[model samples]
Target: MARRKIVRSPDLMLLRRALKHLLPGALLLAAAAALPRVPSLWRLVLELLPIYFSLVFVGGFLLAWQFDRSRIALTLLVLALADRALLHGGHNVHDVVALLLPVNLAAFSWLKERGLLTPRGAIKVGALLLQALGVAALARAHSPAAVSWLSHPLVTWPALAAVPLSQPALAAWLIAAGLAVARFVTRPAALESGLLWAGLTTLLALLAGKTEPLLTFYIATAGLILVVSLMETSRSMAFDDELTGLPGRRALNEELLKLGSRYAIAMVDIDHFKLFNDDHGHDVGDQLLRMVGARLLSVGGGGRAFRYGGEEFSVLFDGKTREEATPVLEKFRAELADTPFIVRGKRRPRKKPSLPLPAGSQKKVSVTVSIGVAEPDGSHGTPDRVVKAADAALYRAKRSGRNRLCT
Candidate 1:
């Protein structure tokens, strides 16, 4: 009996990552939101929770920034500080500044969408500094007239402070919500998902006429995003090949376990790889692997490629027969042969060059690959056996000639 070939769905992968980052934060916020229902606990903690939340946000932001230098963390930190300043010192100023919060968040989303604010860019830093300074100045300004002038339209128009459905604030929330949705649909990045949750929490807090819950939820959400980001980053390091940027053997093994029927497996090896490494040096060899990996990544015939240990690769074609996979594999092999790799001469001389010392050495090297394709046959009933069959075919191809395909 044939089993289906394994395939990883991109949408499902995105959903899994989002849930990994969001579920914990969602549960924490739910608990925090419910805490205020207990009158005694609410009164006891109300005065202290804001301070605690502020500290949590600040500390969490610092830790996350240290770990990953996240731009989102930094942005949230500045916003949280501004929020605290407005709450404590400037009641009237708070009204004015709160009106602007949504707009600032929307602008941040816009900048991120445009690629202007990246974790590595100075522009984000400059933007955050400007926002902090602007918010601080507005919140601390002692001029009641200026505060009233700025606040009157936002505070008095339609009298929605209790519901926080004012035009400016409402517009800001809408923008943030819209950005969050766009991110989930288009990118589904961890940071983007966190921002969406934070935005929702802020909106709910505004509607509930409470600050403590907002602060609590913000802190929990920020911390959760940081934790998830760190975990995901670590997992990638473990499962991804750093040199070639392909999923490693561990990922391949995982994929193999999920395979269904009628799939083809191809074992690919670079021709004379050890000789190339010994002659050209390890650096050139690494470049060759990267080049081959890039080609394999874009393999035709709906193939998924992986680095299957040292100097070896695997391509999985789910729901395809060997006949269907052969043309695709052959095309990949031909492409590798046609692409010439340029190797620059090293600055320092080495003992015993791998290739014959050049009489006017040509810097160009042509790379070729030997491939062995296998499908489910009576003898190869399991995934493991199928892989072994492909490996045996690979050896045959190498034995018969260096750059050819075997089945």
Candidate 2:
């Protein structure tokens, strides 16, 4: 019998990260599905669609500017322009937008974010101008002929006819979707995932007819997702440590505010971390911090970990006493001491390097932590004071002996 390979914690963590970025768009899409389908209100909603989209796009542009996510701002600008073109121009322009949008969106999203006021940004601006000019030129030059040529079905099969898009448009959507998926898989971020779902919503809008209320609904949803995800990304960047992927000091500060009277705070510090950093390098030190943060995430006793800056970390145990949390912190300290951390050097092998280093290129070493647990007391009335008390205990722990827990 063949053995089944088990999925580990890191894989699950990666999956969670990918899915989290999809939440904003997915929620809006769900809301769109649940909208009331009343006949009387439907026309009103249709009339309001353009107005609604105008607000969403304009507001989204301002937010993108605030967050400095230029890609989202530009995408919204282009989408707004397309909406305007479809409203003013005829069938040829519709065909022009249907064919051009997916391709342009793919280009805008996949291209590196060059800031809007720069040389590269000028090129992007030029591209936008060219797209608009092409639509106008084509509409005036070809009249109704452009629609027939652009909408010509590539396949005569009955199944293919049921698809709501023209051949070139469908092909472009498919390629754009593939790129979005690939980008999301490689680096799970708001931009990549937003591009993936926003592209789908745009395609759905095209399927429903550009001037239809459904178009407004999907396009508005797309704009909202782009804006909201950029906000989410901005929040994540603020509260998360870039190197460790752990909650930073600001997050810890907010969390501390929400704690009750009986909570325990444990300050954890890696022993001789500076010596390690100096001996190895900052890059290696970063790797160590990430590894340590990962381990801290799995600490026991209902504790939530935060990267409390540098080589220090903090674990907040809501509603737990100091005595109760001490043993848990001790166990964590001992377990971390036992786990061997492999330090990969410049000459380390491309594959996973195993025991017995080849001329000191790689080596396995045990890392340990000193922990101090504190509970709220009359002496430490406030959260900040409690943290200071915990730090004092941590200093005591370090003084007594390294790699041990203190009360």
Candidate 3:
């Protein structure tokens, strides 16, 4: 009987990875809800909140620093201080945080990474310290003028006015949210997405408005999002190729560990890639890799692609032999070979070309790929051995001819 084949896709692989990282936080929130929400439990959670926040921040900050994620490290520092200032929520703590959180998120989210021990890092830290002190000073000088200033209505709409956040705070949140969305749309990344979600999570906590159990739980969940985001960011750094945006060698190895018996591995190399780099430049070489990687994403026969290393890529066809995978590779190679790759002049704009090109300056470069496919054998018992066999086949293909596939 044929066993059920487990398909592996970069998308599904990433989804599984994300779920793995998020499960603990979800379970923690669920467990909090599963237990009684009475006064006794509230007291215990509230008392322990300080300890929990301390450990998470200290540990998360160290990890972020070690990973050299200055953005994440600064964000952690800001949120922890905010929690200390506003977690208890008296004397307009909610109002202040609502007004300030969005601005802080936008500001810190976009700041480029400066090392923690550097002068710029000290300035950034000082700026945050000043903000925290300002919040503390406002909290202490809780007179009528200060209270009204913090709670003044910026939006007069009935629905918005009724929410826990003051009209002014709501307005600020809206502006900050817009900025966050714009920044993300223009330059999407892990931290921007994380901060956007974390802002929404914090807003959820703010909506509960001093409600026992739920408020603290949501706050903790928000913190967890920030912490886990750093881990995810680090994970991407390791597992994904930064240039081509394909799964890196590490991800390929991880996938190989989960393979079934009937699977074919195809090792592909761009023909004369180094010639392109040497004649043109590394930039042109980069463009070729990107074009190839983009095409590989839509490969046929249910093959998943990886940026194996350098100008080489690997594709895995689950539940297939070399014969079955050949047609797919043939199609891909034919398409790539037929496509005209343009080498633009140095001054050419990335968008519409501002100036006309000189004749023969920008010309089409012929591109081709050599591929080798292999399946596991009794002698080649392991995934690594199968890959080596595939590599040997690839070398044979290259030797015989530069633009062909072998099995």
Candidate 4:
């Protein structure tokens, strides 16, 4: 038998994904870490960094808006507004705003985790309004001496022991770390990864104890996250089937190269698909294919389904024999036949003057599939050859009787 191709392991895949999202931020962090070493560069960067950050955040907001990512746009806007306030505000104003920053970030992360904020325009507008009110309140309000405990050495001791961060800042860092771990373990989405990297970069900047580098890293990380998100979206479009939401032929080809020894391949075709398409409208035919694809997606026996092409699907049973796969294929075929597909009736224009008008009544239709199973053996030495054998067996099934299986 042909040897399986060396493929990336799960840990390797996860690491690759993390690195892809973190690379840009990593570069920014490196640049920021080096800035304090040179006085002239540091001064120059400090003088111009605020302007650069302002433009970056503004441009990020516009891009997010254009992409209909309202939540992200609002986030960028909030960051921009806070940055501006900190740059121009007095000491008391800075302290109040700085205290609010972590609380806001943690709350936003919580809302995102629970899926409460869905990037809707109304939600974005409301959030922005609330942020504006909070900023206004902080601007006019004095720091309460009653809450002076917040800045006291006693209150700061515990946080300092853990990290050289304040309470609110520590809380925000913890929230970001938790979000990143959850995302990597549970879902591993691009946006989540980006947010995690951005958060880490923010924390790193804070640890460096430099104001200019902090702002610079913040803007750089935001821009990188946006770019990565767009790249991931485009990749999804290329790999996923638009109609059935299954992996397409290209995906199947890639998967085949990764299979190990002792696997079974099944070629499935809808029975009399062309005749069905001709009798019913093409739209109805498309619906039938969709239904079949959905059913194949849930196939058991350790099988993974792919939309091979029009009216055909391929199921691969990793580490299975023909005997192991046949029963599962039979079960799927039987279930498909038993389920009735209902098509709502519609009035059609009369083709001939003599023909009477048809009544609008719903019609029930059923579809059946013929599957052919083949396993790797001496005769079929390669995956492609095994697929061909399954295809030949599929033709045999069609010839024997439309809806039967052939091994």
Q: How does each model score on TM-score? A: 0.52, 0.88, 0.82, 0.51
Alpha carbon lDDT at 137, candidate 3: 80
Which scores greater on lDDT, model 2 or model 4? Answer: 2
Tens digits of per-residue lDDT for model 1, 308-395: 9778999999899999999999998886777666564565243335666555563667788999999998999898999999999999
How much is the lDDT of residue 279 in candidate 3? 94
Query: Which residue pairs does candidate 1 place in steric collision?
Result: 3-260, 3-261, 4-260, 4-261, 5-260, 6-259, 279-354
Predicted model with the maximum TM-score: 2
**Candidate 2: tens digits of C-alpha lDDT, residues 1-407:** 75322211244345656788888878776666556366677677677877888789988998888766778988898887776776667777877788888887788677888778889888888888998888888767766765687777777778767776678788888888887788788878888778777877788777777555677677777787788788778888999877677789999999989987889999999999999999889877877887788777778789989999999999999989988888888887887787677776677663544664455554667788888888888899788998999999999999998899888
Q: Write the per-residue lDDT of candidate 3 for residues 1-407, one digit (tens) a residue.
A: 65322211234334444454445445544554554457777678777876776677788888888987777788777776666666665757667877787788888767778888899989988888898887888777775476678776665677876688787777777887788667655545566666666666666666777664556566666666777777777788899887777789999999999989989999999999998999989988887887788778779799999999999999998888888999999999887887667765578666545676676776677789999889998878688999999999999999998899998
RMSD of 2: 4.1
- The alpha-carbon deviation from the true structure for residue 93 of candidate 3, after best TM-score superposition, in angstroms, is 3.7
In angstroms, the error of model 3 at 253 is 2.3
- Candidate-wise lDDT, in order: 0.68, 0.80, 0.76, 0.66
| Span of 10 residues, lowest total lDDT, candidate 4 | 3-12
Best by lDDT: 2
Candidate 1 C-alpha RMSD relative to the actual structure: 12.3
At residue 25, candidate 1 shows an lDDT of 49
TM-score of 4: 0.51
Backbone clash total for model 1 is 7
Model 4 regions more than 4 Å off:
1-55, 110-121, 142-149, 153-165, 208-210, 238-407
Query: Sorted by lDDT, highest first, which candidate order results?
Result: 2, 3, 1, 4
